[model samples]
Target: MDEINSSKQVSVRDFTTNAVQVLDPGQDVMQWTFGGLSRDSGHFRDADLAKILRNVTAAPASAFKACRTPEVLRIIEILSIEQGQKWGVCTLNEFCKFICLKPYATFWDWNEDEEIAAAAKALYHDIDNLELHVGLQAEQAKTLWPGTGLCLGFTISRAILSDAVALTRGDHFLTVDYTHMQLLSILS
Candidate 1:
């Protein structure tokens, strides 16, 4: 932290710490790295998972410039917080409601694990203010059923499932590119 702070570069960590209004000055709050899909969760108005992480992931290692893995992860978390602050994007419950799923009623509902829920509560103060990325990642992953593909957190699975359904239902391959067998072959 001191090294990054000493350099001329703007400290994104400091920005995030301030932007999110860290609930505890003594505790380090990287709110989005909750062991779920945080690495994949920066999707919002000005920031996206790929846009936010591609450069960091592609950065030169032991070369001209490099970022620590934790630093990169923190940047993703920071982007989510900044996006929420700028755009007033929906919180986790609101997002679930938008997507036709039940909103998590409490922090415990968000993550069954006692410790994780406690940590999230400490940082966010309430479920109503929980950032989309943070709450989405904090949710405990649902058990994968037989023959089902994803083992994602409950919210992530539902969000992804809805998106995938929309994409497949509106696919150009089944509409714009539709074709029939040649006339000669059909006759034969």
Candidate 2:
């Protein structure tokens, strides 16, 4: 941190001591790092999973850079305390609600139990379908998006954990406890 402060090129707009927000202070916090796990890992926005599936999985690593953009920054910013309060995050519940109402929705249209049950059967086989898969249960999904706070449904951290579990069950996944947003991406 002192080195960061000393660097002429470094921005001094903010500083921290032990993650407690000593400079430009607001919340009490600490930092954590997830690294050096055996299994492969990558960080991504919910919106960017499609891009990753298309580019990184389907094409090549060189094709990956095209999908990284400010839009991702904006979406992730919704999870940070600094910006989340100002620009509310998109709730998965709200997104689902929109799906139920929107005439252009590519997924299930009806809200009734029978229709939802039928849709569930269809989605069960193709669980990777983004339009249908939100990792939260019904009650949790209804929880108001804690704007300027963490997403009420599945968090980015949990998503990473889920990815690790999916790839190699019981494999260790590292993550930090701090609420301040951080980015972790695996290029490969």
Candidate 3:
């Protein structure tokens, strides 16, 4: 575990400077595009991703390794693609249309999250009228990115780290995109 921990502390580029060829010829380069794109985007800094992986594994309750590997990188690439696709369709117009089909509260469930309800009430001061609360929530939802998929980041993070294994070579980072004020996860 100590050796594993030490590797994560090292600069990612130090290791990556020596590129390891993918052993499998049929390993579908297209699937690896997200990984390459993420690396090229400058958004997912390798060192940063290494740090995040370290942080996650450092948690006392964590059941994951801090090592990065090709398999891990592949998983991260897929996750990035999923996030990009979700964001591509996460337009305000789409949110408005979605709200019309279903009340925003159904997905958000203000009552379920006391903080959400309190914040809504604080802004509107109309807890008595359900319609007003719903409307206020809808407006708030519009201001959020991925208006429909609010908890996507948490979900994806859990999925990515659920397996109890050490990190390996191609492993990358998954991060929350807070700019949209929505719970979105993206490949870093």
lDDT of 3 by residue, 1-188 (tens): 22434543444443344334443456765445433335454356677678777987785442211121334344343444456556654432233344443333332343435565566567546433333213322333212355553322222233335433325323433223333334333333
List candidate 1 stretches off by more than 4 Å. Answer: 1-10, 13-71, 144-150, 176-188
Best by TM-score: 1
Off by over 4 Å in 3: 1-52, 60-96, 99-101, 105-108, 124-188
TM-score of every prediction relative to native: 0.55, 0.17, 0.20
Worst 10 residues of 1 by lDDT: 61-70
Query: How far is 40's C-alpha from truth in model 2 (Å)?
Result: 34
Which structure among the candidates has the greatest lDDT?
Answer: 1
The better candidate by lDDT, 2 or 3, is 3
* lDDT values for all models: 0.66, 0.35, 0.40
Q: Which pairs clash inside model 2?
A: 84-148, 85-148
lDDT of 1 by residue, 102-134 (tens): 888888888777888888888889888788866
By TM-score, the better pick of 1 and 3 is 1
TM-score, prediction 1:
0.55
